[model samples]
Target: MVFQARCEYGMRMTSAPDPFHIQEELKYLRLHITNFLSYQSAVLDLADLVALVGPNATGKSNAVAAIKLLREIPIHGLPIAIARRGGFDQLRHRSSGRPYNPALRLDFQFGDNPVSFYELKLRGMEGKRYEVKQERGVLHFKGDKYAFTNNAGTLGFTEMEGGHRSRVSGDRKIPVPAGQSAVSFPATFGLFIVARVLQLMQTVEINPALVGELQEPSSTREFEPDGSNTASVFEELTSETRAELVDELSAIVPGIQRIELRRLADKVTLAFVQELSEGKRREFLAKQMSDGTLRAFSILLSMLQESRPALLVIEEPEIAIHLGALRTLVDIMRQQSETTQVLITTHSADIIDTIDIDALRVVWSEDGASRIAPVAEHTREPVRQGLITPGQLLRSDSLDPASA
Candidate 1:
């Protein structure tokens, strides 16, 4: 039940519109994993559109989480919140002991005319504050190579072919210390390319259908990780655009029509105004819509309208959606993939049943080791015959069989 699929390699994907520009070719990105969950070893070339499915706890979300964590590290990798959460000790595989022996590593290759490759090895150490034990950073491009200019806990670089890179700390020349990830070292001295790549690789794009956002209140504004921004976003739309969106949305979602955002005595809230025949009206305040319906709309709007992002990870989308919405969600998901590489962890058989089987990778976890297996028609038989539903299978005991 653990999805494991070997990441296909030795192939080239023509570049996409530059992610930096709305219409320019998005830079083609290749997300590869040599050894990851349910895969004795696996590597996957994420395409513009792809889908993944497996039983609950079979490690479906874990795969997406792994990718999310990787992209987040160089940025917020060292946030104080992590330390508060039991420090770096809690960062590694919970099952694996100190040293986090089998650390996950990611290799990146970018550019053209010359081409280049960079690798990041994540090593966790034993200490009150979990620190990185080793990081070997290098750049190979234009028939020349440079080593990780090392500094105190950071990785750095200098003139490879007389071209000055981004500046680091202290001076206009020096390598990064070993203590910090070369990817995250401040861009004062020089490691600019690495800096740019890390900057560009900021967020993980999630499959729209499965993405969820819960409402949270705060004095300040923030991008809701779960995407609770639809009503807020709609409130700002032009009257014409707002009307079109609501009209189309209500047609698909049923239960009447119209939506209004109110600034009440102290806070902002959404109101769903429904009209039965002949002006027979009803108002299901944001407080009135089912948690699931509100969540569904928020998820749909965010995915359908996001301007740009580094990556997106959609967790089990089938949870709250009806069968009819499932198909509509799929249509939009594939359309977005044309410009963004979206990853999804889902369990809805109805959704996957209609997808290209090869697009999915079943995942399984055991003894802290995760494996990814490609879902062949044959593989689905066991999952189908377990005579089980996703709800029951996810909560099953005896799942961590040590050597899955």
Candidate 2:
């Protein structure tokens, strides 16, 4: 039996009705980090395809982790998410001797609409407990700005409704609970939208070790972060979609005839069918496939997913990938960026060379704090003279701020 794909917002389809067509909306505008992890203060301007390249331990992964932490807050609450990362002490920057407040300020704009901003600040209190220092949100629409909610100091909650300002909780200051966010209040509709957008943000740290493992069949439509449920997801795709994926894979890796998902009474697994030199056919289980083949297949499945996230953050995608296939992988990612925003971290020159200079950001450390700058700012002469590519400058350490 063949299944039909369901089209939704931010999803790419071969053909669909008018109702399924929607313009690409910008979900994230900017991300500001202050005293969070290795960053003292830095702002990253988001784009369709963002690539972060730097030496190891220079806080490339930390930037991705910050987004993951923020994404978890609206779903799991604030305190639980902080505790999962070794508590507040570990999250705040330790370079300064004095106590610090770690904050994340995110700006969001949908389509051509006015921009909206949300800021969350946290500081360690007595008994090693963390509390919200200041929580505020604003929505700018139709030449007017609306402040959703502000919680700070002795002030309880100042909310704006229909362009009117009113204070809630009267004279007594209502403290936000340790595990909650002020913007998470259900009464504020604008603030709730911010929370919902954050909830939709997804991060994936692909692990090649888990990609080839067999597992129980699942009805999940989206690919998991670790790629463990790839077989199940492929089994659920439409016939047309599966054929398209097989064709793409065959082009990337020659001699591949087709990919099949085998189902038993208790388990489901993936089998790669290939054609030999004599036209002989052979099959290999997922675990029996090469690492590069398995990784490539998993990445291809993820890019072709019909129900992809609004923002997809992938860490070190170049790992376990063949050098010859890097160009194909880059092209696939660039094509998918039109529908879903893609952010990736890499140390591979081949991958970097394939990306535009405007899409690349250089991450480095200086004065015990991690910093990021656009590649255009660092390699102006080399880029103008066509002396070296961004990847070459990065490999030669010319993009490092400390070196400048």
Strongest candidate by TM-score: 2
Q: Single out the weakest 10-residue window by summed lDDT for candidate 1.
A: 1-10
Residues 133-218 of candidate 2 have per-residue lDDT tens digits of 77777755432344544455322433343344443322434344544675444333344455556655567766666767777776
Error of 2 at 344 (Å): 0.7
Clashes per candidate (backbone, < 3 Å): 64, 0
The per-model lDDT (C-alpha) reads 0.47, 0.71
Where is model 2 more than 4 Å wrong at Cα?
A: 1-23, 96-99, 140-146, 150-176, 183-187, 376-378, 400-404
Which residue pairs collide, candidate 2? none
- On residues 1-404, what C-alpha lDDT tens digit does candidate 1 reach at each position? 11111112212122222323422333434444433333223444455555665556755554554455454445454343234334454444444332342234444443332323334444544454444444444544433344454334543444343244432222333344333455454342123343344333322232222222223333222224454444455555567755655655564567547777766665556677777568688887676666556555654454444334434556766666788876666666666666555667776667765455446655665555555655545444555676543334334531222123
The lDDT of model 1 is 0.47
Q: Which candidate leads in lDDT?
A: 2
In model 1, the Cα lDDT at residue 200 comes to 38
Once model 2 is optimally superposed onto the true structure by TM-score, how far is the C-alpha of residue 163 displaced, in angstroms? 10
